[model samples]
Target chain A: MASARLPNLGAGNYFGLGELYAAWKNPEIQEMALHTSLSALGYVDILRVPAPILEEHVFPFMETPTSTTMEIAGTPVADDALMEWAVEERFVNATRVMVIDLDRCVRCDDCVRACASTHGGNPRFRRHGRTFDSMMVANACMHCADPVCMIGCPTGAIHRSVEHGTVIINDITCIGCATCANSCPYNNISMVAIRNPDGATITDPDSGKPIFKATKCDFCDGQPGGPACVRACPHDALKRVHFQELNPAGMAT
Target chain B: MIRRSALPFIVIGIATFAVVAWYARFTWLELGNPSIVTGYTLLVLMLMLGFFNIRKRLSMVPVGRTSLLLAFHVAAGLLAIALFWLHTGTLWPTGSYERILAVLFYLVSLTGILGYIILRSLPRRLTQTGIEVVYERIPAELGEIREKVEALTLECTEKTGSDTVAQHYIGTLNWFFRRPRFGLSHLVGGDAAGHWLRGPGGAARRYLNDVEKEYFDQILELGTLKILVDRHYACQDLMKKWLLVHVPLSMAVILVSIWHLLLVNVYAI
Candidate 1:
């Protein structure tokens, strides 16, 4: 749409992509969105067209009959339940999602170790999750499309990134109430005891309760190389992908 | 990771080690003090291997990729063994202190090899069982299965009005339901568990009436599920427990190597 808007701008003579980007940057020329501006600046990819969601996963959790039903419907290994969880949780919102091809995974916990390498000492996700014959969806945040975890935060600390749609928690504002942790159906969010730099647990000054903070996979946001877990996987086993890419036939349940 | 390209790395590593060994052999014959150089190099290699544990602990630090580090550690292990053989110059060292160091080194090497074998083979076998469970949660999963079995048994007794199924529970099936039984059987890929489930676990089936047989089938279903749990425990448990042996012995070997380093400097120098 923005490309169409810019087709006739600057005397309709576009020299190059830079001139298009410069004209887009100028508010007088065109009111460019931050996402579009970022794309023009080569910082992020702007999806010019809509992505194709799975046919079976046309409805969100609220509209679907299975929203409150926690039971596995049928053939959880690689059937309806698999994509249902993905779509219901709104995994399509994020730019990329983590997927594990279990046949290639050796259970070495290298991804977990890499995650710990990025975060401080605490590996954000366990290598265990729902599995079919070999594929496993590890218990890490999917940065959901709806982000139910963000809804009940008392302080609005857990919010999606304006630029990248990454659901991030502001540690300074997070009161450790665990609303987001509880709200997450996949149990991706973990309530960890906040610790000092010396590795001692920090306690509340009055109640003496250990200070707790909810943590999970952040998609390695702001990291220079992006998603350390995905990069550190030596075996081409792990990947950050969209739900549209998953094929049930490939994973033999 | 995948061992696809590791063949080249292995070939190059072995070739490089052979060349070093030849140089060390010449030094031993001509210079009469190659053990010192080999010992120092082995000590450094051992220290690097030990640092892998530290790297695991300080997981937050982005020093290097863990698989790359682990690959280096394995390579160092192989080279260290070759260096040890060169240092002693004989299969068994005559010196009392040297013998103790050699013995400890041998144990460490053996355990490390066993650990690596366990690491390489069991994970794919685990996936074949069509079950994925966290090691810590195995007991809870077993407990839940046991609970369901117990309830089904109660229903069978109430509906059938016979203690035959109840007696079977107290006698044979109860033992299997209690915990992760037949762990060793599962580890060796034995069908003893399935045999026991059908043979011993099915002993009461003949005594059951048509109505009672239905409940027994449900019990059998839960038993099969528990067996999958047992398989998971067997694979995951061995993978974790082997490390306990490898790590403590590694620390001991390092200590012995440190002592060996001191004694040679004190007396031979």
Candidate 2:
């Protein structure tokens, strides 16, 4: 856990512009891992943290004085629900994942469509997801700290990139067992029918059934810029955020 | 603010068109074929604008960001419309061969503008729906709603010795519950489903006793959910399917524009 990245990550999002510039200014922490745990900053996974430990360290942040929904003016669905859901669903299990500013998102499938274009014409995520007002936890892979999708991979085809923690599935080794698809609780992974050069579905010879492959967002692997979805959003709505930071911000319900 | 924003593209597009328009105007004054310069210019602009599709395909490459490309594509498209008018000097072309090309061009522009509007406005409206459903999953969600409605209809019959609610399901509500209904209505914000639920749905409730009314109330709640899902279906359906028209027509515009170019060079030019 590179603790030097905490103040840079907290309060302001890692994807947020000022934070990126600030991070770049500090060369020592520039090479921090995508999901750098903040234990050195005196915080661990929120799920595992005991109350007294969190109270002394993290509780100060939670004391925003604003309560849930109507109590703080009633328009919100409660920031607590957002945090609780993130903690319970393990959305923050990843260091960084796509989050949407619904206030900004125009429901343009540009992000989703751009993702598909990057990954051989099959979109890796759904724009549709759990929403709390203008914030959406879009159903894209967070490339979790512990990818549950990796549990049943018979061939060990789905693996994390050593360079960046992007979860990539090797198309060649993948057997289309659909283990990852079923195991993914968020339904981020989809089993798309494997197609050939002429746009015909490749069939399993013995079974004579259309072969499938487990597909999801690979964080635009090997691409120069970054995730195409974030780059594709004209509205500046979509962001690849540290889910750990999102919990305290309480953007979703 | 201007440099980082799409203002540059807009500024650049206008400046280039103004330069070309000025050049074409001088050529026209000299009684020369201004169509050649404006036509060629429009063709080049179309190629640049049309390359957005190609850019979409080449996402693996490091050309530029797709969002910026789209913003530029749109700015370029609008300027091309100006150049289009400058080239032809008329909105409608009289020549039969040119008319087909003109029609195709207008269709492309119309669809593109419509798509721009859809992409701009649809997302916010979708968020207002308070639920996010995948486009493909709408049918299954509808099916789930249908199942619940039918079960409620059945419960109405069983709990009370009344088939009025069941009869209502069979008669009026059945059609609404079947598949996506009133798509055009939803598209136009007609709220036909909501109106039906409130109007005819209320009318049907009058026939029910307290026990049956309880069942109807639950059915109405399910109907409301169905309406939201249908709204998602209509909007998402429009978002994806409009590309079917816009993309192919865009490609056609390219093909026809090429043929028109060859014809102008060989015969007219």
Candidate 3:
């Protein structure tokens, strides 16, 4: 019906209008026309375009645009401001970042308690870490994009989970070598000595030596609701954010 | 489902010492000799510790996790030290061969202890710096920063028509940029680069024109980045080089130990 209507406009209006109509029907002409129309209307602000459209159309053709402010429909829209708004709204970072908003935290230790309870009374992660403003990214296994801790593991005990990509230690296979503990730049992994059921230290009878195991957070693998620490945080201060999911270009206001 | 904790290790270590002490006393008093038993035990432990390197090499095989072996290796090492004392019955050995063996043993033990201390403390120290860098990438990163600095210097000299920054770079900062500098300072957590940059960079800034100042700002940023790269190198280099000391000495200890074992068997027997 739209195709039929195009010809009617040409026949009723002007002599050369038919040629224009035929040209407009071509895909290349259609794209050029759209581009010209948007440019003429001063709608060239890439940020104002919907994300999918901008990503598909503008981003590929444009020079990598420096983030700056531009006017859209008589309103000045700052790209950095848009990024900030997106970060708050969508939690975007080019790298995955696990952040805890400390201002919202009551420090009740429920998250720690929950983690310990789930992990047989030994909390995998510590509550302390470097803080920025009020946000404290607690000492937890980041399951880094490139895990150096995996390098020298003799038994391949520390590995990425196939399902979730969380770095996990095989408890059954883990030998308390402390290699992972030492290798971890964040000091997130720890060497723990294992004990027998009688509450005595398990020792090699021949050498009279204690046995050790390397331990760290596994991000609650196979748990129904994901990370117990995040789930148990009643104050909602804790969040397991992947920095990669965060829009790198956007800043959160 | 056993919980991992240090309490078990502490308890085990104390228990091990108590048992070893009791065994040494009983063997000396009742059997009229502890050296035969303790010496053999020490030899076996040295063998086991030597095997740890082999285990590390065969990482692809699922024989056992290296961590477990390392834990066993450390425990065995401590036990071997205790047994060495029991076997010798004195701090110093008397025979020339015995003394040589003693020297090698002590050297091995000292390095082990130092390595253990480094292993325990270095990670925390690295984290405190809050700069995470891969050991292998440090050189590449340093190269990139060097290139950036050189480009900025060239740009500053060309755009501003003044070689003040360029001359300053050549005179002072050239040595800093040539390769990783202040490595020892970085290892000790000293900011020699920062101090130098602030002093010299500030001094140079007064001579810079406004346009040159912009280029200088970029250069300063690159300089700061270089300092961080150096810090990464110092920390990572220490981590890598210490292993060089520990591993080779460990190998030498094993070799000399085997030779000593044969000598003891040939003469003493």
Output the number of the DockQ-best candidate: 2
Q: Estimated TM-score per prediction? A: 0.72, 0.71, 0.52
DockQ of 1: 0.20
Interface RMSD of 1: 3.2
Best by TM-score: 1
Candidate 2, B80: how far from true, in Å?
0.5
Tell me the tens digit of each residue's lDDT in model 2 across A1-253. 2112122233322222222333344548855332333332224333343445644565455433222221322334353565556655667576557898775565656787778877777888888777666688888888887688898799999998988888889999999999998998788888999999888999989999999988888888888898888877766678887776663343422
Whose lDDT is greatest here?
A: 2
Deviation (Å) of A168 in candidate 1: 1.4
CAPRI grade of model 3: incorrect
Evaluation by lDDT, superior candidate among 1 and 2 = 2
Arranged by DockQ with the best first, the candidates are 2, 1, 3
lDDT of 2 at B225: 90
lDDT of 3 by residue, B1-269 (tens): 11133335435655765776777678888955656666666777788888876655433233543334555666677777877787788889898877877887888888877765555545445554444455667788888888888899998888878999999988987877888988888877788889987887546999888999998888888888788878767766675567677777777777877787687779776
Alpha-carbon lDDT of model 3: 0.65
For model 2, what fraction of the real interface contacts is kept? 0.44
Please give, for residues A1-253, the per-residue lDDT of candidate 3 as tens digits: 1110011111122222222333434447653321111111112223233445644665456553321111122243342443334234322321234566544443445567677877777888877775544455567887776677898999999999999888899998887788989998778898876877666888877989888899988888887756777656533457776543433222121
Clashes of 2: 4
Per-residue CA lDDT of model 2 for B165-232, tens digit only, reads 99999998888889987677777777788987899766798877899989999989988998888888
**Quality of model 2 by C-alpha lDDT:** 0.77
DockQ of each: 0.20, 0.29, 0.02
Q: What ranges in model 2 sit over 4 Å off?
A: A1-90, A101-128, A144-161, A165-217, A231-237, A244-253, B1-5, B26-32
Candidate 1: tens digits of C-alpha lDDT, residues A1-253? 3121111111132123333343333539664332222113112333332212321233222232321112322224444645545444544343355677765565556678789867887888887776645677777887865577888799998998787788988888988999999998778899999999999999999999999998888888787656788767644467776555565554322
